[model samples]
Target: MSEEFPIQPKFGPFLRLFLHSQLFCTPQLPTQSFADQTVIITGANVGLGLEAARHFYRLNCARLIIAVRTVSKGQTAKEDILQTVKHRNEADAIEVWDLDLTSTASTVAFAERVNKELPRVDVLVQNAGINSKTYAVSEGIEQTMQVNVSNTFLLALLLLPKLTETAKSAKSLPHLTIVTSEAHHLAKFPQINTPDIFESLNDEKFYNGQSSYEISKLMQILFVREFVSRINAKNPPSPSVIVNLVNPGLCFSTLATRNEKPLAARIIGSIIYKIIGRTTEVGSRTLVLGASAGPTSHGEYMSDGQNQDVESWIYTDVGIRAQKKVFEQTMKVLESRKPGLGYAVGL
Candidate 1:
């Protein structure tokens, strides 16, 4: 009876504050519906990428291609998405294909398959990434660098024609959306200086226990800028393609558990993480935004929920100044590998 006499709504003040803050906030939301657009989100078996696929489908996405390293996992994820949209108005159009972003042969093969099967890829989300304590190798390159940067770069390059085709065919030109990370700032600029990255992939003894993950992420942003420049140089003005990068804020997921830290260390880290770590759903927001939105700016680095000009953050503009060198080095690494089964540049 006393409470009823003085009932006050909790969060009333906070709600008022939020409403006031909205006046100063920037507008959000895509200009158009995602229907009829085909999006390929890598590493969609789980984590942020998986969440993106689910949300996109919920919004009645025309097609969702979930690229996974594991075939069984991919199949399972496909089934789950189908179940969710089972009662929806449109029939399910979700697909899952195998893609290992560590091997050149694998990346090329996946690209070739996509070109053959997918007439248009409206959005390409480079969401798959890896980090490690010791320098690991894949296809004669550091695992972190290769998977996060080199392999991703090769895939993007290989699919350029298809992406262009998709854009040309689409009502609205398509976009290339890449998922980089805030950890990029921690890297010592993008440099292929560490030849050990190539030598250490096969020789664990030669591998230094170092974090190449940050460097790889740095290279990712650099690669995006380079790719955009190359496309512009080769294409006419007012090209249909748009390229953008996004950094999903820190999230609690398998990426944290990947390192084999002590039990107490893990517990303490998790507790601290719980205090600040964002949910997977929140982390996927920027990716969805970048993928669906047309070119707000070319080669923009969307991080911390803000799109920062990556060109401003560079410590050394050497790579930017020497586009040809960077491109040649990347192509050299990719072409060095023997063309394995089902691997080809063009259909």
Candidate 2:
């Protein structure tokens, strides 16, 4: 693999990925049932997120919330999941909630609803994300950066208290999993010296959708590192909330080609996906594993149902500086949305 993108299957990483993907047996199912547990999955209208919802429902989770941008689409997903359930009574266990990751206001509204409505949240799967071929802006920010990095963690921070409370009351660790991507290894850590890293990312002169998407994934990983550090540094140390990042690898889903407008690009993507991509069912297993993982998985980067090591570059001096910069900028943006929010979360 290229030195900058070491996670690609081009060198020793290729062999590791090959063994993990092709040689491994089915992922180990969760030994413990989700009985009476509440699970929330974003982007559950389709793809891996929808498949994860099915798996959680089958595990008999007491309350399953499918959060999506479109209520109708989420309802359709809930109905589809219900079709596979063994009993009709289980239909009531699933509810569709509205969430638009493009808007900070929408994310905060969703978080408020969750805090007010849900009694507890045992597992939170931050699975919603987007990639676009052309430049687009949402809420005055680049679409990919807004959805994948800003709003994604905005929702997570807003719900941290609930996760902590649930874990403390139940005497069990609650999981907060953010679905990341191997593409993160490609990030160049642009604008490291800028005060507003995200604003720099939004500048059109340096824009490339693919690179922007990769950088957003990198930001997610960095956020996880910073978030876990802050949680550990709390006065009493909040061990109850276990946050993790997971990469499902390339999967045969619309997520890969949804933004490719050119017919040629779409055709080539489809062929590549057919040849190497895992099914959505298999890809979703990684998300489920991350959600059900234990304390050992805290702040870890998991892939192929295991806590694998991240790229060595993440530990380099330059990488650490970039991570700290991104983390500080991310907190500033989030706290700007709600004053004192970072302090409230112990950031």
Most accurate candidate by TM-score: 2
Candidate 2 CA-lDDT value: 0.83
Give, for candidate 2, the lowest lDDT window spanning 10 residues. 1-10
In the range 1-347, model 2's lDDT, one tens digit per residue, is 22322322134674566446644545565446778799999999999999999889988889999999999999999988988766545778999999999998899999999999999999999999997768989877899999999899999989988998898676468899999988776666545556677788889898898888888898899878877876787646447788999888788776885764678877888787777678888889899888888888998999887887766677776556667778888888888888888876776
**Would you estimate the TM-scores of all the predictions?**
0.80, 0.92
Model 2 residue pairs with clashes:
1-10, 1-11
True lDDT of residue 223, candidate 2? 77
What are the runs in model 2 whose C-alpha is more than 4 Å off? 1-26, 29-31, 235-238
TM-score of 1: 0.80
Error of 2 at 96 (Å): 0.4
Off by over 4 Å in 1: 1-32, 83-91, 189-210, 304-306, 311-326, 337-347
| Alpha-carbon lDDT of model 1 | 0.68
